[model samples]
Target chain A: MTTSFEDFAAGQVTPLLRYATVLTGDPHLAQDVVQECLLRAQQRWARIGGLDAPGAYLKRMVTNEFLSWRRRFKVHSTLTGIDPPTPDPAGRYDERDAMLRRIARLPRKQKAAVVLRFYEGYDDAEIAAVLGCTQGTVRSHISRALSTLRAADRVKEAL
Target chain B: MNTEDLIRDALRRQADLAPPPGPVLAALHRPRRRRKPLYLVLATAGTAAVVAIAATTFSRPTADAPPAGSNRPPFSTVTGSPSPTGVPSGKLVSLEYAPTWLPDGFVEWRRSLFDHGWQRTWRQAPPDHSPSAPALTFEITRGSIGSLLESADEPANRTTVNGAPGVYTDDGLRWQVADKLVLTVNLDNVPDARGTIRRIAESVRPDRRQIRVPVSFGGSTRFTVSANSRDDWTASTDVSYRDGRYMAMLHSVAHVGSSPRTVTALGREASYEEAGGGVLTIPLAPDRFLSVGGLGLSGFQQPVPVETLTEVAALVEVDLGVDLSWLGV
Candidate 1:
């Protein structure tokens, strides 16, 4: 069945924006990236809509836009200072917020691989396809990212 | 309590940051700026002139002309010194001719559009990490075709293309197809080179078209964009100010090499350096970077401040999802 661009975009934009948000760590930039991708997709929706998995295709587009958005503009979320999460009443560190900040600081590819794996639940093959790299490269990216996060965890434990 | 579980939970929480899609959808519905009419005017003028020349040269009656549709030599060759033709004055904005036929397994793989001409290449297979791979190239230029023929190492074998005089040499076939138009076909490592070159040259037809680049700039109106190149995986553009005071180049290829320093631009860490002028390399993807180099100069030709380059980098708008397949050869 041939789906119109409007219908496809209307149905897919939310999920795409979510994925982009996690990948970019910036909701506003995520919106901009998703909108830009959707506009481009609309420009050639006649061909994209005929694909067997237009949603997946658009997801890949969102992934690529997130990957490249930094080069096009200054990405504030990644570099701008973030206030530390408020300590719980018990005075324990907010591990989740700390981890999110660390993940945001990871290199773009490593962050993308980790998000695709943990957040998107993508296997190495699928992540490789989206990242335009070999499965071995994807594994390397995820491994390096986990190492960085783990090192931070050990420092917290020692302190 | 494990790191994997912690990461997942954190990511889910971050996903909630995604805003509603209403604003984005509304932005998409807004009208876009129309492309300049200069492109249309140039395309129409170039096409009409080429069509007129092609029709006149090909339709001329000759006693020795082969019967219609039969596979025979359409024009005879004569030995003579090719005359120097006047160079065309205007910039070439559209491709005016394309090969109507190619060898059985050939597929276009690269294309470059410059101010004075465009070149396209076709290969039997992907270059596949081999720069020396065999291919065929078709080029049309309004620049000096005589210079190309003059630079040939071997003597030229004079020939005729559709009744107009041309030259055939070891490198390729060259024909002054019109007053300002020159067509050249280069065959490399192909079998039956002589026959292939002749057939390909004869099969040329008018195909006027322009490439819609994936990147656009909403910067100053004084800057005019020109000279675009694209291949299988990358594209680039050159923009220069009218008075030649400043120029900026944008490239899609990543700058993986190390730089001496980094500076904040567009709120991101960008590798900065000053070789000839200021160059900024911003990470676009793990494998790709948008390289914006500024050639700004003061009245005394001194390099301008790096801030000007930063501003130029900010003005670039990239549509990462645009299907660039059309820009390929």
Candidate 2:
């Protein structure tokens, strides 16, 4: 007997949502993606209920939903033009927090590539599988994203 | 710190900040999927069964599976060992060859057969005396090598393993053994791993096996099986079981929208919904459900009894294990 979608969700909903949360970088949105995916998964439970790695399948679903989430519900909540107080001559900004802020500001695909590659430790092929793109595309996404991040660091160090 | 390390640390901290697991689960139980109306919602773990209303004619095996080149077909080892009395049999699998030999201490780890063009994968324990992991794994996919080539992060080098024409890459050794069948060996760490890989490739011979997951349902719920996925995780299938003239056509899935009629289907709380009684939706989660739709369930000519749908759901066994290791829960 194949697993019911409910069982799969009850068992997998946590990681699936967590993966979605990080992938989307928002708790509410992660819940939305997981719910959407589970609803879709329930529709195909018969076909997918028996795969060896249903979680992998659902993760991919979450990823696709995430990409769609980006396209359909692009967040425009940037704090534009809000200049911070001048740093006291001896005061250094928290580099880690700055790096993370920049990372969060990355475009959706690049951010996804970063999270999947570095945070999740998935290889290029696996990341591509999750993001539904060619492995080469994943490489370029990472390369461009890392380059941008590195450029930011270089500018800070020069200052 | 390096960018990667920094990103990893920040992300991990953020992940740790994920609002408790119990909340995550509770939030999904809230209604939403039923309200959103959009096209193209797809994702994956092992197999993400997608449901659409397109009138797709059922094709045996997969016709869209890109044709594996004539010379090298893919490999899918039959699942499960033989019953100890008969030869190893699996569904829709034809092994062109089995290694006449394997390195000592190498044992079968797992085997998977996919029904969508039915790709196969087999892994064996690392050869004894080898330190480190990324064990030797074999993957056989049926369809176009173009998809494989397209997904490759590195370019493939045209070469032959064991005199069999194939492509070599940092990815692994890939070659199509028969028409529409491509085989690959992922050797992570071993002495002269490539050489041993080639030897193993050479030893494989055509010893095809076919096995099918048997299905049996009791009572008036009897039906034949079709359009079933062999991917092992969910084994999600599209079975249109017929009880003589009375037929029940159902596939597994989650809910979309509208209220539901609850039933104890197959010993679980099945939330059932019908649209004009043409479509039957069985809720699996808050926003997820399995739908039995099409001309059969719709009662186009005659209203399909809810009893038929319930029986069909009952016949399906939903036995599965879910892993949340990634969730850290």
Candidate 3:
């Protein structure tokens, strides 16, 4: 039997929130994105309930919502950009922590692509599907993004 | 540790920084609908179901195996298992190509990542080093090299090495090896580097240590993914049958505002208009049809041939993620 809407929501909302947090890099924004998407999702519960992978379906919605937030909500009026995690003193920290800061500073699509590639363990094709572009484009975006993050290493080595 | 492992750890740590979601759970109330369902049963089914879901915990949903007969396999908090887009588990080949011959007093100085690939540099001895020092740099790009659109500006000379086509310049040489790799050499102020660059380019052979996969174009250029509905009413799917090369999108609609010509697609009646981002609509169920768009797209955007669109409609087996069958009804 298919799980009811509330049961599905109750069971799945936390993970959705968590994924959103990681995606948006802000817990509050993550909550907003997830809540809004879920509100929209509840309206289509019937069609969604019959789907083979309802959770996957919902996750994709949240992802799109997060990706398109700038256009959909006119968010640019108030918020210029998401605040990046603060970098530590370069000499004290290793590449991993430094890379983490550089990662947080990546542009939205680039950040999303990198996260999907490295953190989510998705391939170029999968990432292209998620981010809505060609695999070649995904490869280009990932390659460019990672190259920027490596700049910190060059600085570290020079020191 | 590699970049992948380090990134995974960092992300998980960032995820840990998120405050508890307990408040969000307590506030999970369905929005009120403006249009009441024809039957009271419909209007209240969702709110009606909330009481039953009260005991459910906001933990992992796909922890257990789904009941048998389900097309989907068991899932976890991780990504779905059925995703065909598998990340390459096999190691990528990492090999550096160094020229067999270098100018006397030249020392191998740097090996680092270059644009879309790797590069190795050799700087001349300090006695030869002035404000302008001669150096040799070889860049080998490993990803999607064959797709590089030929440029009109380069007065590039066509050249080949070992049957692989390349371009040669006075200063250096460039090669697109085996359609899977690209190697370009630039003589950055280095004198008498042409002969060495050509030798290195010609001597370059497939490496055993490099990550190897059966190279094929049929699969790499194609992709299939289930689209998630932006909302309940709108339903759509895009099939990149040739991956990035060609893309076809189908949106659910009952009918179009303008008229169209009817044609047979896979023996079923279909309608298509060829002008202005061409659209082909095929009747799937009564009052519900799949409208395919993204036709006649030029440049990098592959035009979806009408026959390909028909074939896609004919071959569609299941509603990928968002069930389009219920749309536009």
Candidate 4:
């Protein structure tokens, strides 16, 4: 049976959009990217609908779109002045918020790898397929991201 | 919490930021906007004429051309037409080399131009929407090929491409096409892979056509402009000072964040941010925005002032009517 594009998009758009949002750190851009990918997917639904896991294919498309979007946009910013989240009246800070900001500043592939592992619960092999890279490269990206985050945590503690 | 737990928690929280899918679904059914092509083909004028003359003069094969299946470098420098504005265009802005032929049924589907080099991909069918779908990709870089066998699980075999030394591994073929240029061709799930890859690599020649972009940067002569474009039709031109302390980027897509602080620029309201670097985003249309800002590369240097960014933003020219159907979504 050939599944319809509308039905596929109905079931998959939420997860795809959520994944893109975390990957891009910008919801509006995520929407644009997801919508673009879906539109293309619709044009080729006859073949795509026949796949065993169409959602996985769409997810990979979103990941690739975010990766290429960074290159096309080419917006460069420094990492020096990322402001910490507001402190509570008790003088405590939200470390999660700070971590999110740091994640936002990671290089594109690293951030995507981190998101795929932590959010999607994807193994290195799965992430590798989505990224169109080797499993070793995927591990390297995640390891580098963790190192940067840990180093940032240490600096915060010292401060 | 441990870093892993913290990352998981943070990502879960961030996932809520995804907007509801109603609008996206609605947009899918709406009629797509149609626009005339923005590219101006002045084939008989200015740099186009020069390119035409050069191409004709260089049409004959060089006497030293390597024989078929010979292992030698087959590339010769070819000049392309320049943009009318004297902005670097054509060979200066496009890929240095492109395959003159491909196996039957292969079609060029995507190309990305960057500051240093470009990448082009071809596939057997257009309907393969999955990113992991089988395709052939050709990439050129401005630096060393850098350990062609670095990622090879098996020992790489030394080979030749058009008489030039190359390394062939399970992953792909890599060769130094020129002193500063390296080329790699990757094949995935293609029929007769080895012979096809060799034939495609051997057919590479100088391609000097200027890539068309949806927007142009006329900002300042003091800043050198580096333009890049993607197959999706989204393009950007980044202008930076020689010292790299200040820069501005103009994109054909809007990148506004939530609850952005608003200010005035170019007689219109714009979203502004001073953190990391001063960023001024002015909406060009419902779907497009222009961003202009730069940060200091050195620790002691400060970001460009907001006023300067506003001035730079004023100098951008955008074409809202450019056809964007290729964006796929």
Candidate 5:
């Protein structure tokens, strides 16, 4: 007999959520990604249920959702002035925040590539699998993202 | 700081950071009757089973299988032994070429084989080795390799392993290894199965180049072992079983991610597959742990081979050192 979606949820959802968090970086946003992925998987569990690695499907869904969310919001290409932080010599946390802000400023694909490769510790091929692109594309994203991070004057000053 | 290093640290910290609150399982589970289209269902179901099976199947028979393009006959010995008397004689139905063995106390449901390249065979365990394990299931087919590959989708990605290319699809992620045969060590299930699978795959790695460990009852049963492990622990081992005895032991380590203690601890919990209206969890501690037993009450086929199973369990223990926990035999 086929396993119920409820049982599948109990067995598989948390791993997806954990993965979503890595993808979106916002727990709330990750929730949306996870929810959307779940809905998609549920609508087609009969097929996914039989897959050797349903987890991979869920991952692809989450990554795609995150990318789509970015496009829908048109959040990329928006520039913000790096406000001079309140002076604190020892609070390296400010530097971290500045760096995060800079990373946040990168284009969506590049950010995803960086997050997937460095944050998730996925190899180039895994990053490609998650991103639904080729390994060369994944490398390109990483390369472009590093360039953007390097060009951010605030990041350099903080370093 | 270098961007790569910072990126690495940032990513590590991200993994450590509290994960965001995303979709809950409760929210994901939708009632049936609202399911998606038929093609999706077929596509998905077809992908899962076919991918995992293919992932394990298409590799070298053993770790020592001849390297790619070596032009050497991968088979070291023609060891296909004839079936013994009283042995179930039928089509070589389904054969799951799993390098690993099943944990003690785990019983395969004997049911009618239909599609999925499965054929029915003797339901009873070996008389002398009753309760045989690690329980493995395999099926052979007369179709072309493409027929099997088509059963599943193309692998997720392709790579070269030791100058050979291997198409791989497992769980969800798909990839191909080139150059050399690749052994997938999940490190997330029963240690015995994991170790056995690794060992079996590695045994034929060299000249044999296949992951399938061939066994045959011959004169004065002799066998070989091949292994690869980190400085701490090995991941795979191969041994020959004949005349209720183990002839050789081969061991190997796959990926070097953590220490043995970490791996041992990681291997504790049981990852289950839904079977027979219940879940089967194979524990990973104290080798030969019980998976499910006492089938006398669990509604098994008649002529319950309780005695045979027990005998197999004992033989496994004596030969393989499997610690079959008291499973209410």
Candidate 6:
């Protein structure tokens, strides 16, 4: 028997929304991303309904959306001669929160590679699949992302 | 100091924010609105059904499962028994690709998405050795619509479609249009059985006029377009609108490698020339409309008249949230 889209979505939307929020940093955009992801998933409920891990597919979509948004932002930013705005300074927040925010502020690929690697605990191969790049590229993204993070950390410490 | 520690903390924070109760289930079953496009229905049906099955088998707990360790939840659980939600299962399908039907003069082509599954990628048909020939392209992707399009190498533009924000970009080499509706076609996979897929892909084009959607939504709209038999490709849209400003959030798919029957059953088939080869009207205002043709096209040009359309008109309501005046063109 086929499952109802509403029931399946009811159980999964929250976690997926959470995933989208982390990827996009903006709550509204996150909601938009989740909405788009879930909406699309709803259309294909009958087919994808049989997948081994449906959340993996949705998560990939969320990541792709976040990547797309970042690319668009970069294009617009380039046209306006604006680099991504500097991230706000870490206030009384914990070091981990501060570090994660700093990581979030990196270039799209780099940030995703880092998040998929360290935070999501995905190995290099897994990160490669999610990011749709060669494992070497994934490693490179992680390397660059971490270097940027570590550099920022040192700078923060000096400040 | 390991990177995983930092990443996990952030991921946990992200997981904490969930969709509000009650609305979550409805949001998944259908778009948050009433009206819908065929493509949305196919894609959503595919996704929702897949998730439900996965949840049943994969979410089962195993006592001896691996520890949660540095990760969290559902560690190495044994697969469970089927808890079918009872939605009718459509035919298991495959998409096809072929290089010959491409008109003669197109410069280059590449396939972005292809696999033996319900989804297929979109690309333009090749030009017939004519410089003025229009580009042809199609896309069949299943994730973030924004991400699927923006990741391409071509230059894209950010603009609003009928007031909804989106990106528009293309280059002469190959073209891609990704948003709620994606367009682009590849030449390598069409089988003899998939001619209908090619025909549908050839039919997609950009539209000039704007079609209005008449629906109320703080909900969602799920739309889909698929390629089926040699002479048939079907497109569908479904919306689940809740009370809100956005009529319905839209999602669409253009399948190029499946049979018409398969496409229709899956909800990915679309009719681009239904209302003439320019605009495929949704028949529901403030509800949905799919426009194909004009300045909005990329790749080898077929008839792409707004295949998956949606609208979110701004509403001016009083303190009681009752309608005062509807604001939108």
* Model 2 CA deviation exceeding 4 Å by range: A76-93, B27-329
Instruction: Name model 4 segments beyond 4 Å from true.
Output: A1-159, B1-94, B123-129, B132-134, B150-156, B169-171, B189-192, B210-232, B237-312, B317-329
Determine which window of 10 residues in candidate 6 chain B has minimal summed lDDT. Answer: B315-324
Per-residue alpha-carbon lDDT of candidate 2 for residues A105-148, written as tens digits (9 for 90 to 100): 68888988998888778899999988889999999999999999
Q: Quote model 6's TM-score for chain B.
A: 0.19
Question: Would you estimate the TM-scores of all the predictions?
Answer: 0.38, 0.36, 0.35, 0.41, 0.35, 0.36
Better of 1 and 4 by DockQ: 4
Off by over 4 Å in 6: A1-3, A71-97, B1-4, B14-25, B28-329
* Candidate 3 lDDT tens digits, B180-290: 456666554555666777776766654433321111111221111111122212222223343321122222323331335677654456676443233455554332345
Give candidate 4's error at residue B309 in angstroms: 9.2
C-alpha displacement of B180 in model 3, angstroms? 51
Task: Give the docking tier of candidate 6.
Answer: incorrect
TM-score of chain A of each: 0.89, 0.80, 0.76, 0.87, 0.75, 0.77
Give residue B306's error in model 5 in angstroms. 34
lDDT of 5 by residue, B215-267 (tens): 11222121211111011111111112332211111111111101111111112
Error of 4 at B254 (Å): 12
Model 1, B43: alpha-carbon shift in Å? 46
lDDT of 4 by residue, B259-306 (tens): 257886655567765433345666554544555544221111233455
Over A1-159, each residue of candidate 5 has an lDDT whose tens digit, in order, gives 665655455344444544554454433234445666677788898998788767667777777776765322222110111222243486443444345556665777887888777665688999888888999998899988888877774555788
The chain B TM-scores of all candidates, as shown, are 0.51, 0.37, 0.31, 0.48, 0.19, 0.19
Maximum-TM-score candidate: 4
lDDT for A159 (candidate 4): 90
